[model samples]
Target chain A: MLKAPALEARARAISKELRCLVCQNESIDESNADLAHDLRVLLRQRLMAGDTDQQAIDFIVKRYGDFVLLKPPVEPATYFLWFGPPAVLIVGAVGALLFVRRRNRVRAEPAPLSAQERQRIDVLLREPN
Target chain B: MRRILFIVPIVLFLAVVTYFFVAMRGGYNPSVVPSAMVGKPVPAFDLPGPPSPPNYAGPPVKLGFTNRDMLGRVVVVNFFASWCVPCRVEHPVLMGLGPSANVPVVGIAYKDKGQDAIGFLNEYGNPYVAIALDESGRTGIDFGVYGVPETYVVDKQGIIRLRHVGPLTAESVAREILPVVRALQVQP
Candidate 1:
């Protein structure tokens, strides 16, 4: 069995990563809402009472939903929440790269100035000077 | 043009990150009253009072009253539980408000056993006129109660004028609840 202080520290660390179900977005550690505070106290008490780390998390998850986890489980139903952003980033990067390459390839190279056009340009430059 | 186009994805990414950060900070404030429920009459309720226990030494009161009994009188219906810590914190505030606020206050013992509710009232000093047991939370559901320590102020006309969603503080009572009661008193 871990010392009480060690157990408390571990509990705090775990709770900081868990969202308060009642508050939705707040980690259990940071929320001052009554439910959040109650959950934190409960977590600490359970830890002191000899619940293992997994047991503690499982206890909360059972009562609340998977929503209580800050990092949601990478299950089939939650795959989008976990992987959607990175997938968007990768797709955006690839799309942008492809667009730039296509634009470069399709850019109209300035029509090479013919000899007559060059001479006319030279005359215009001289006249301007 | 390419450089500007490149910045779009980055900007979008930044916006998504900012949203997540704001959400993590719990930017959604819970105290704001929902506009939909505001100015609307409170849902009707006729809750059964908790079962009277043997040797219950608290206030002598009956069970089952109508909304009319609550209206035209400044009344507070507080939802509380013995396990809730905030209920303990707000008990004295409710007690103080009972006599001074010119209103009758009632208690809704939510999701707790009768014995526990009686014991809680005994320990806390029954500040309520009557205690209703919401053992199954059906009454609380009718009132749309999300949690314990919620106080509702019903107008003389039986409309729920205001809901204080959390623990009652002295400042909130003075600033919010008192003015509403004062207005209700002068209604013709």
Candidate 2:
């Protein structure tokens, strides 16, 4: 832990962004894994050495790749990961709209029950015993 | 149009099923994260041998190696620990690598006590041409090692070509390690 509270807080913030490679699910800040501890220590050291937050993050990212970041950066390979859900939602919404519109159009007033159909209905009613 | 629309859900369901079927058949293990260091030059660090030399049983040997030592030679760098169970299983395979493969195999004892590493090496027959003690595991972090018993094949230019996670099996030795080392050796 750093002696300076501000620095320590900064360190903690940075650690939260890094995924503990061993634990996979937990951020380095929350992990008890040895690797996570080391990374936490490394992050503090980098901060103390006057590295900007980006530089410190970049240091780990360079070693471990973008997977180390809790939030993956936007890139060509990750376009699907970032946009696929919204794209699916938009497509689904459009499909539902088209479906509902088609249903509404089919149900609309039934062409006022055309005159010929009405007359047939009347004839059938008059023939009933 | 409605007929086609009715089939859409089935088509989507089948697509999802096919995706899973292919992934399952491919033997995908989610835990195996690919190394980010491949194709990059080895991380810079100077690591030393075990603190006390008396534990070693073998003939006197070069204790440590730096990134510079890796240049101009194809070498296999292995990260192992005395406490790591799989490393013991992988030990004999490492022992054979030095002689049968004819390439220098370097060892970095990760986060292990100097004495324990020396003891492990003495008991198992030392396979490393050069051994480095990574007591703090700073070097291991630089190499992006998440676990023990990870192996890397470095090319003559000191760039990391391959990283084998987990204990190396004989099949992996025959397939991944030997082939990469051989290919790197012939390159000028």
Maximum-DockQ candidate: 2
Query: How big is the RMSD of model 2?
Result: 2.9
Interface DockQ per candidate = 0.04, 0.74
What CA RMSD would you report for each candidate? 11.9, 2.9
In terms of lDDT, model 1 sits at: 0.75
Q: What is the C-alpha lDDT profile of model 2 across A58-79, one tens digit per residue?
A: 9999899898999999999999
Cα deviation of A126, candidate 2, in Å: 14
Candidate maximizing lDDT: 2
Error of 1 at A50 (Å): 48
Cα-based lDDT at residue B74, candidate 2:
96
Look at candidate 2 and give me any clashing residue pairs: none
State the lDDT at B59 in candidate 1: 52
Q: Cα miss at B188, model 1 (Å)?
A: 3.2
The stretch of ten residues in a row with the least summed lDDT in candidate 1 chain B is: B30-39
